[model samples]
Target: MKDVYLFSGFLGSGKTSMLTDVIRQLKEKNLKPAVIMNELGKLPFDSQAVEKDIPLKEMLEGCICCSGAEKTEAQIQSLLLDSDFDVLIIETTGAAHPVEALDAVYSPLFADKLNVKGIVTVADSKLWLHRETLTPQVRSLFMEQIRHAHLLLANKTDLLTEVEQGQVVYELQGLNPHAFILQTTNGRVPLHLLEGLKATTQADKADIVKAPIASLQLGSRLVEFTDVEFSQEQFEDWVRTLPETIYRMKGYVPIEGIKNPMLFQYAYGMVQWLPEYIKMPAKLVIIGENVGSLPVIGMN
Candidate 1:
């Protein structure tokens, strides 16, 4: 069984930082690892953050849920056959849902090429408390990222007080009490945490209720707002109007103060934004559970 490690986290939660550091440490010990960085946008930062000694590739412009994960299998199969490295590290897009991402790797196509080393989720301790205010699709994305992980690297601990760190971990524990949680800054996770993991989640085929990306009841992304351009104020209106059932919201938006475009999500009435350090074309995907209504916008 080959070892495959996934780096999962919310947008700007330091997935790249952690990945880069991990690769560096592995190489320092003369361990070679292959990488697959998935993304919805053209530019993938994780691949570049890594040092040149490591072999890496970027899978962009799609989600793991691609028409039932067929594309994901194709990509992974290609990587497995082409790379000579001992381990595969998959860095999922911020838009990715970890369970769904796991499903992609566990597909029958590469079943022999991979065995989950462990799933590591990066949690931004500073922003978690305000996550609810992000868009529904965004919140669900974060919650889902943390849901099925066997090990979680609770990054950004420096931003919180000792007591507050406990609060964040407690809340995350509420989400996935079984997972081993580690605290760190800039996603400095120990390599041992990724050594062993097995995910038994049955492949999610349910249309609405068990969907991986949306809230169980909120019907997020049902209001699919993909590739649409919304200004800061317009984005704010959508935030104000989001329904409670919408657990996550995400995608790119053109914000006034941001130059390289920006990504934002709403969860628990908290709006979390990650400034794009590099300019990328704008795109968005919103998921809401059971709402069934496409977003209808009105200019004020």
Candidate 2:
């Protein structure tokens, strides 16, 4: 039977980074891994992180647990029939509920063919510290994700002070006494910690009630910048002017005087720019609450 692992986390919690690391480790061990990525936006930005050689299925424009559940089952069925992979990794949207995601994956048709591992959740330490600032619904969803995690990663610890880090660890431990919590930077975790794991048993799962789908309706907008090169300084200024409702933004941006587009990522008021050697499409996906009302570019 193939091993199946599910990744659960909020927006900009570094799920893709952790997924990439997991894929690399599995490949090094001579294991073939297939990926199923769900995105809230129309564009499949995160899917690009998976290599072409790896079998991949993408469910776009909805949460895998809700509207995409049927599509997800179909995709999984297709991958199982056509792919030669030994392990399956499913990464759900940031707004997805852990219980619902698991429900979609536990299809009776293929459940016996897989050995279900567990949910690996990445929690941003800084976000945990300021979670109260978020709307009650979003905060509840975030906590639910952490509460259901079998292995929780306190990610982005590098941005937290020692006291804050300790507080995050304490809070997470209190919320999930059964989980193995690890403090990490950039979602880095040793692969050995993830192996031979089992999902929450039937009795343990009985305790988790499904979250209200109505409360988790985060929005996303895909902005394409074709043949347009932005001034780096101007872009950063524009990002600063964005409202706090915008939680995560990521994609490639073409900068003036740069030969290739730079990978841009913004999360929780922090922006990171990494030089990309390859010429990726110049598009950005902004995810947040009512993000469609936000301007694609703040500067004229």
Candidate 3:
């Protein structure tokens, strides 16, 4: 049976960094491994940064737990048919719910061939301590990811003192007594901890208390503009002024003067922009709650 692993965590929880480590170590042991990186935005950074030698399948434009489910299943099936890897690692979008992600993986087509060896979740220590400060929907998303984890890595422990790390572990244990929790720095977990994970099945899962995912008002909007450039600083200022309800936003836009289309992302109150080569329509997918109207730099 082929082993399948799911790595889940919230945004900026270090899932990609950990996955990169696992892939490198697995290759050193002469094990063939493949990866699936799922993203909510069209522009993908994690997949592009991973070691190019390993086979990678990028699942983009939507969450694998929802709209991207069908595409995810098809891609995995395609991977299994083409090559027999020692393990298949699935890195879910930070916003995804673990149960839904597993449902996608356990689809009937590959049910007999693939065994879910484990579900590894990485938790941001600082975020966990201050979860109440987050919006209800964001907090729920973070907690739900921990609910069904077989292994929970309380990552970023270095940011806290020893006493604080212990408290975080204890609190998380209260939330999920079944999961084995380990603390790490920069997601530097030992490979042995990932081995021999008890294979889990649908029968093992408890009836999940459904979160108000629909009521959370999660949505996406596509905004388009005629090719034109605006002052980079002005564009960034507009991004910073977005309402707190806006959780994530990304797009490629043509700047008034810059030659290359600019790729930008706003998440966790942080905004970033970079030069991108993919020449698509100058459009942005704004994802948030009640994201009614946004500032446009150069529009027709």
Q: After superposition, how far is residue 79 of candidate 3 from its true place, in Å?
A: 0.2
User: Relative to the unseen true structure, what is the C-alpha lDDT of residue 45 in candidate 1, on a scale of 0 to 100?
Assistant: 53
What are the models' TM-scores? 0.63, 0.67, 0.67
Indicate the residue-level lDDT of 258 in model 2.
96
**Counted clashes in each candidate structure:** 39, 0, 4
TM-score of 1: 0.63
Query: Ranking by TM-score, best first?
Result: 2, 3, 1
Residue 140 displacement (Å), model 3: 0.9
lDDT by residue for model 2 (65-113), tens: 7888779879989999999999999999999988678666754345546
User: lDDT of candidate 2 vs native?
Assistant: 0.79
| lDDT values, one for every candidate | 0.66, 0.79, 0.74
lDDT of 1 by residue, 68-105 (tens): 35566676777777767877888888887765565556
Per-residue CA lDDT of candidate 3, range 1-300, in tens?
Answer: 777889999999999889988887888888888998999898888897677777789988899978887798899988888866888999999999876676567543455467677679999998999999999999999998987677889999989988989999999999888778889877777777777566542210122212222212233344555535667787877777778866665566677677766877665588788887656556555555444443444532
lDDT of 1 at 267: 49
